[model samples]
Target chain A: MTRSAVSHADLTTLSAHKVRAAIREGAYGGHTAGLAAGKLQCNLAILPERYALDFLRFCQRNPKPCPIVGVSDTGNPHLPTLGSNIDIRTDVSKYRVFRNGALSEEISDISQVWADDLVTVALGCSFTFENALLRHQIPVRHIEDGKNVPMFRTNIDLVPAGQFSGKMVVTMRPIPQAQVAQAKEISSRFPQAHGAPIATGDPAQIGIADLSRPDWGDGVQIREGEVPVYWACGVTPQNVLLDAGLPLCITHSPGHMLIADVAEDAETTILTTP
Target chain B: MTRSAVSHADLTTLSAHKVRAAIREGAYGGHTAGLAAGKLQCNLAILPERYALDFLRFCQRNPKPCPIVGVSDTGNPHLPTLGSNIDIRTDVSKYRVFRNGALSEEISDISQVWADDLVTVALGCSFTFENALLRHQIPVRHIEDGKNVPMFRTNIDLVPAGQFSGKMVVTMRPIPQAQVAQAKEISSRFPQAHGAPIATGDPAQIGIADLSRPDWGDGVQIREGEVPVYWACGVTPQNVLLDAGLPLCITHSPGHMLIADVAEDAETTILTTP
Candidate 1:
């Protein structure tokens, strides 16, 4: 099996586990943006056990950007709460290795670098709720334009936890002026998936001086009749981790996610098993 | 002003600040159950700054029980988040002073015992949502019967945060079988007021051995055709704080509360001045 072989296969028809197995076998190393439909995909963060407590506290303090779905036991490569066979070392399609707050390497596997005191934290991603929005007939401009969602660093400071402290990052989506309330109502139900919009209308109020130029991801064009809505972005935790300047940290490359067995709309509860 | 004088002057109809002034002046020491209607009522938690961070973490972890509305800055007896002129040491109708986890005094004021290193936390109470339930024509059995809502210590352990770890405590209300969905919908709106019920159905499943006998509040009769619904109780935080054995702690006496400027039905935001 190879990366091209998996790509050649029916991408949307594969189960999450099958797709993960293919990724683990060096058969796939592509973005997981729309791969496994109806499955819960997660943003990954792996840090040393020493910072686990503080990181956990940080997630608790700021749930909008970091709704924790699963936490791997200390030094354990397998995540029991996300999926039964998830091996954090190889399950992700691609991994971004960070050292002292800077990206050092991009790899297909972290098996050789796995340490005995590493802890993996899986955060709920916006993709799940974005799918829900699309299902409800909400227009997602970025998806239609075939570009990554526009993201911005905001003046809104996330509640600081221990040594982890930074401003919140947000993703923007332009909604038809009349659909703003409906959009908020639908998204508010998914607190695990960034909940409701943090700000709307004037982006400058939140310190975003330019909507045409985002700090991360490709910027989307806002139509004349549309309003830009801001949601806390998953990039927040990653940014905070980088700012902390940890000796070693690992995260999934942007747009690459860990697809879990849990359904996208599954009731939010602590999973009894992986 | 004397208690009778304050009561006769329609002081209860005054704003939260004026009502609190009456309480501060030793004019009112009665239960705050129905006074200052439409205002947010909070349960109090005062502890030394050393334990404040851990307690905040605990509240963040177990939000269903400790839905934090306001947290005072270190040694600042005022809760600016809740209301202007809201002094924690004297605003509540009554205060229960605890020393080494044991109840040491029940007083109307704690000014003499206030410390420079103490942190005050104002948590949401069920009264806010119970009013909503009643407004929606939902019957609150305990309130109808003029009895205390039954509370039980469950076997469900809260996610531990530092030194604060204990079993969850819940309050029970019997709702009509058909109104379970309605109850859940209405209560879910008040996340700061414990959101929705943690469990609904046979109480034994969550480790409640007897429904007629409660560990804390007076047990009310469960009428025929009604199903028992349990909600995470505000008492859980106080109990957990007691169990932590801090050198000194202060909380509002049961039924007494610290009324705030925020409306009970107000939609809350992370930056809603709190």
Candidate 2:
């Protein structure tokens, strides 16, 4: 069960470059939450060029869920703008391989399957915004309880692009009713990190009949006086891509992400390389 | 030359739907600045499906310059999501037809060249953000001077996507140096409208050689104690599409835009049909 003697806590102290280097060398294959400290962590998707265009469109059309921080050139594995010395093939804790729209296997390194037409997409994760919420004294239930953010498939239809189409999926956090607006403002600052909650009160309005049972990730407690606030989740793209039954697809394991060198700063406004 | 009895200002008083109807009937072909009042005005690009995928990727990669508001399905002229009864063939003030990357001719309607493989791309215009600036009491030099906003070709190299690549084009507005930060915050609220100024003060930093001689549009004076603030322009995609010398391309004539039904509001975060 124990893959490394060095803990994730130790990885947090190291620079993002070092953390990525360790991952690339097969030394670290653990969840990336809170790792790389202040830098932005990204959810990863690797698809062939045939699906890349459509997938990119889907992300653009649905910005909140799939805020793209970096996209690698077709057949190229390095994300030069996202981080220094970045290599998509071997810099993740684990990659979930999908074939014909089904989970086929799990692997730590995807170098064996890397292809000339492969394209890598890096989407913003909620970790950055969650950190912001914590700093502002707002509760991120799952992080406090040590579980994945609860995600549900909703009746809300996403704007379809090409062969990719699916129902919108949202991650739910129960925020105190009074603090909902504050949470919205804080998260809104990071547009790349799934900015702001889409809906705040009843889940039934979005067609989520059950709050405890999520379609993806683990569920968390909704303390009294707190209401469920939903933000579009990164899993929506993966869900849609799987439904397309692409010949092959790969995504980072939940919570395990690519730690890019991009800092959470004022420069997000005038991003040139993104 | 007077083409119609109605002035551009006269049309601005009409609803967006009525304006599109008038343009569809070949009644008006002037610029669309301030038209539709509160609605989002859009720059237009129509291309064959063969080039659409790349073009879409190009917009997503360089979001600031080519902020996409709506896109039509291939060969479909109706932008159902942008406005009611919207027909790309005849909705705008004028259409500039390009052949092999060179300007071929100008027309009010594009029905003669309508093809099933054509895809329409709607980009966000600066008008929305300009209105925002005015509302916040910030100076928009061109507006005050009754001239087109000065636009320059910048040295900033946009992130290349597929076969689409080009330098960044910027629209310059002179703001009192003290209000630069205020302008940035106000415009930042409208991400769909190119978000915020990419740079301020030194035009040479982004490679604009002369403020008075703009590559496109009319220039306004930079008064004493005022600084030139530059924003990523919607003209960027058109420039790249032209440079590619594609076999066919159609765009909204400068200052002539497609009027869409989207309102400037909080819903930009949970964009449903964008």
Candidate 3:
């Protein structure tokens, strides 16, 4: 938990600030899964101010896949609401650079490509709900295998806004048939974390033809008695944005997220029943 | 419920499309209170395309006070997502024009002032929850009095986004002491409609001094054994944007709202508990 260079194995017990400090100091370079245990972690998308508005609209229109946790002011790298001294350029452990709709580079720091017109968008990641599922005795497949959650490009076309448009991308988890309801109920508590499963039992229903092959991230085994459950993924925005072929776009590498200081409860659309 | 130039007294039984037709044909010119019962109603805000992003971000950050139900594309009058063939230009019964942050004109139709760069935003209104409250046998002071719900500017500062910033505005309803919990529970189910009460019992806590005076709508009576309950109002954005001094901004006049084809459940953040 110390600010000293820490290994990925020790990240789960650390505070969000400590984890980010380690990442900033170049001490950690792994995916943020299970890190900063109960704190909010986000998917990052940095783009020009011009596309920021439309992108924001896209998020607004499709909130389940694009729950905005925090947004930085134009040309500002600091996200004060998410955490103090949270520099967007250096805090994330890994960054994906896209140019003209193609993967151009993978880097640990974006300080070199930072621009005044760039806007930082922090979206809710599935870490919260994954943690919730774990707490409820529901197993998460990718986490158990120490791999990134399997992601697939689906045929579900996102509601377009301005020039931003694309099919939705989803992350799959293998949930035992008996635990699916418990998983759904628990995950539904965190809408910012993509809420509950959009599809269960059949991956082909949402256009994923293969179980072992994924468009992004590592694929996990779906065992007997387990249903392949799909939740709208955070990688969706990045996938859609990349396909838009913008002159420039940057996002957190899949599974490598930005740790935020706020609790999951701080900014939730809490649905409660009487 | 028939759409043949229906009177306000008979409007509640009609569908959203019928209600919009009535308004579009210049038949309904009154506040939309109690109309289109059981359906979603929205507070409308029309502004130049330039300010839409900041305003949307403002809504993103402060969701309880500014839950957006539908947003029109730049220069597009149609909101197909909210309803079929719902034209933004003339569907609402009344429109308030703001010029450089000042109230300038109150008109029946905005077609004369509509421009290609203008964007229409529809936010959740309290009519849905008020109907819920009434159906639950809880008396709504404003509805019982046949007046617009009393609205007040609060001391609570909203989270700022871009050029949009201001204190939240809230509507006050005096609920009987015993039913306040039930009212809160019922209202919590409709986050698109300003969610649950932000404050109850004392108006002075939120900077309101007198119960007989409201900044916007008519004041209602608080009887013995009743407490004034408040919910974040849709007027906060209109109030803030008006204070921002935009050259041309239009909004639904106080108590008059746009009837959307969507149900209250369609666009909600949908908070749920196991």
RMSD to the native, candidate 1? 4.6
Candidate 2 residues lying further than 4 Å off, grouped into runs, are A1-5, A265-274, B1-5, B266-274
For candidate 1, the clash count comes to: 5
Number of backbone collisions per candidate: 5, 1, 3
Clashing pairs in model 1, backbone N/Cα/C closer than 3 A = A2-A27, A3-A27, A80-A274, A83-A274, A84-A274
Docking class of 3: acceptable
lDDT of 3 at B101: 84
Better TM-score candidate (1, 2):
2
Candidate 1's displacement at residue A176, Å, is 2.8
The local distance difference test score of each candidate is 0.84, 0.84, 0.83
| True lDDT of residue A117, candidate 3 | 94
User: If you superpose only chain B onto the true chain B, what TM-score does each candidate give?
Assistant: 0.95, 0.95, 0.92
- CAPRI-wise, candidate 2 is acceptable
Candidate 1 lands at a TM-score of 0.79
> Second chain of candidate 3: TM-score?
0.92
Interface RMSD of each: 5.5, 3.0, 3.4
lDDT of 2 at A177: 90
Model 3, range A1-274, lDDT digits (tens) per residue? Answer: 3445667787778788888888988888888877876778899999999998788878877878998878888888988777868999999999999999999999999999999999998999888898888888899988888787889999887888878888889989999999999998888767778877777877778898998999988989989999888999998888789879999999998778988877865434321110
Per-residue accuracy of model 2 over A162-234 as CA lDDT, tens digit each: 8988888899999999999999999888888888888999999999999999988898989899989999898
Provide TM-scores for the models.
Answer: 0.79, 0.93, 0.91
